[model samples]
Target: MRAPSGGNGGNAARLWPGIGGLAALVALWWLATGAGQAEGLAARFAPSATLASAAGLLRHPDLWLHLGVSLRRVLLGLAIALLAGVPLGLLVGGVRAVDAAVSPAFQFLRMISPLSWMPVVVMVLGVGDRPVLFLLAFAGLWPILLNTAAGVRQLDPRWILLARSLAATRAELLMRVVLPGVVGSVLTGLRLSIGIVWIVLVPAEMLGVNAGLGYFILDTRDRLAYSELLATVLVIGLLGFALDTLARWLHRWWVPS
Candidate 1:
């Protein structure tokens, strides 16, 4: 028989480690959940039970509804961040005066965790999707703004000079030169923002929202559905992984290296 190729061997090498790590994790989880021991509270969280619950949940329409709501919130928050961050970042990067005036305040606001604003946001927005959106947008904003600004700052000065020499209009310069050059950085920011938003989303949804994964989690907890809760957690992790993977794929597609 012909020998296996090096590329296939390399693929196996990369794939096996992840599989092994997951197996080890499952083994650890089994032990920690008191598997094969007398029934206890922890036993309810066994990987077997959680995985089974997750499988069942995946087949449920309500779970899909929750997933849809959560995804919609994430998208809206990202849209808000993009709409606000890009222009502000361009201003901060392209103009020294704007940078000087805005950087300190931006830095200050960025340092504050989005969760810290939850109470005030809920008070003002009054416990609905609006507060959740605000928190998510807040969480996602800084990374995008900072990355975009950095991208702009790192842009080649020669390009700007060349554009100016050609008597390019400001709009033309921004649309043709600056925006294209910063696309990679903007995507990077977007990826980072997605991660931040996903992380914050669960808790943000706890702010009296009637739908979404976060609300489902609370419902599971309130109903004493421990296995379902763990399953929901697993679902959240899987979904977050998928989102990050999609973002990375987009980045690669847009910014080939």
Candidate 2:
């Protein structure tokens, strides 16, 4: 019989970390809630109660409304990153002079965290999706740009030399070779950026959007509804996990070899 493919085995093995983490969380919830470590957690950790609450939230349209709003803002931000990151990366990556000129400025800006920009973003863009989206895109771009540039720089010089020798047009080389060559790095950057985006989603949405998980968090807190707050937190974690899973799947399925 033939030996098993390492690729398939590796794929199967990769899921254990998530599975292990989730299992540990559930175990801890059971332990902490059962131990009566907190005043209200015992009731909150009752799976039946939590499940019922989750079901009730699902039945209501408001939860969906909150989710939709958050999704829209995050998606809009990701789209902006894609639009601006790719070209900027290509320009900086493909040219030596351009890279040298722009690298310092980009590095300086990248060192600044998205949260640091909240005040400026709010003041400049005003309180709405614009500032939130702007921050998300801003935070997400540096990785994509840097990764894409690295990808370009790492490309086999022989390929470009061959292209020049073959008299391949500029557009043709970019379209056929450079783009495909760098897709993996681009996707890697996208994955990292999405993680950042996920972490900041609730905070961004909390900026008085009137609706979103963040708003839900504030409402629950103000009402002292810890169960609802916990539930929302759970939802955020699950959704972020889902996004990461999706990104990984896309990287495997669609990224150029």
Candidate 3:
């Protein structure tokens, strides 16, 4: 008899774990929400109620607006980070003296919590999309900057040597060689940056933005819509997962297997 192909089996093996985990989570959720188990405020956010609330929200147009606003903020912040971080990273990673000078400050700022700057950011920017963008950009910038620099530093010395031998100008070398070589690293940074941006986004939205997931979360709480609040939480998790998956897909597409 011919040996069976492992392709189908391998796929099944990979899929089963994720399915099993989700099943287990649902089972646990039900158990928690069982009569006499989840009481008081928690009871309001029981799985069944939360699912119903989510379904209701899905029927409304406003939910999409909130989601869109949040997504727009994420994109804008990521754009700013990419624009700023790539150049900085290239400078730091390329030149030893620049890296030495900037690394300390980068590390210090990176260690400080993004939310910790909320008071000052709001005070200066004064409660709007701009502040939110600043926070997300700040949160996202480090990963991109560090990764880009690492990518530059890790480039094979031969690549530059070959370019120089060919009389490639600075701009030409960067465009043809350096950029392509570092794309994978930049994508990796972008993946990390997106996750950081998303985490910051929710709280940032809560900072007086009239719309977005974080604002809706607070509104739900104030309205005593615990089920809706839980539903929003679920939506946020799903969106984050989707965003990360997209970033991974882009990385895979841009980089060879």
User: Model 1, range 1-257, lDDT digits (tens) per residue?
Assistant: 99777988887989999999989988888888886472766877888788899999999999999999999999999999999999998999889999999999999999999999999998898988999999999999998999999999999999999999999999999999999999899999999999999999999998788999999999999999999999999999999999999999999999977
lDDT by residue for model 2 (1-257), tens: 99877987786788788689888977777676764444564677555456667778778788899999888888888889988998999999988899999999999999998888888888898887788889889878888888899999999989989988999999999998899899988998899889998787788777847888888889888987667777778788888888888888888887635
- lDDT score of model 2? 0.84
Clashing pairs in 1: none
lDDT of 3 at 166: 98
- Each model's lDDT comes to 0.93, 0.84, 0.93
**Residue by residue across 1-257, what tens digits does model 3's lDDT show?**
99887988988999999999998998888787774377777778788788999999999898999999999999999999999999999999889999999899999999998999999999999988999999999999999999999999999999999999999999999999998988999999999999999999999898878999999999999998899999999999999999999999999999958
Off by over 4 Å in 3: 1-9, 35-40
TM-score of 3: 0.94
Per model, how many backbone clashes are there? Answer: 0, 0, 0
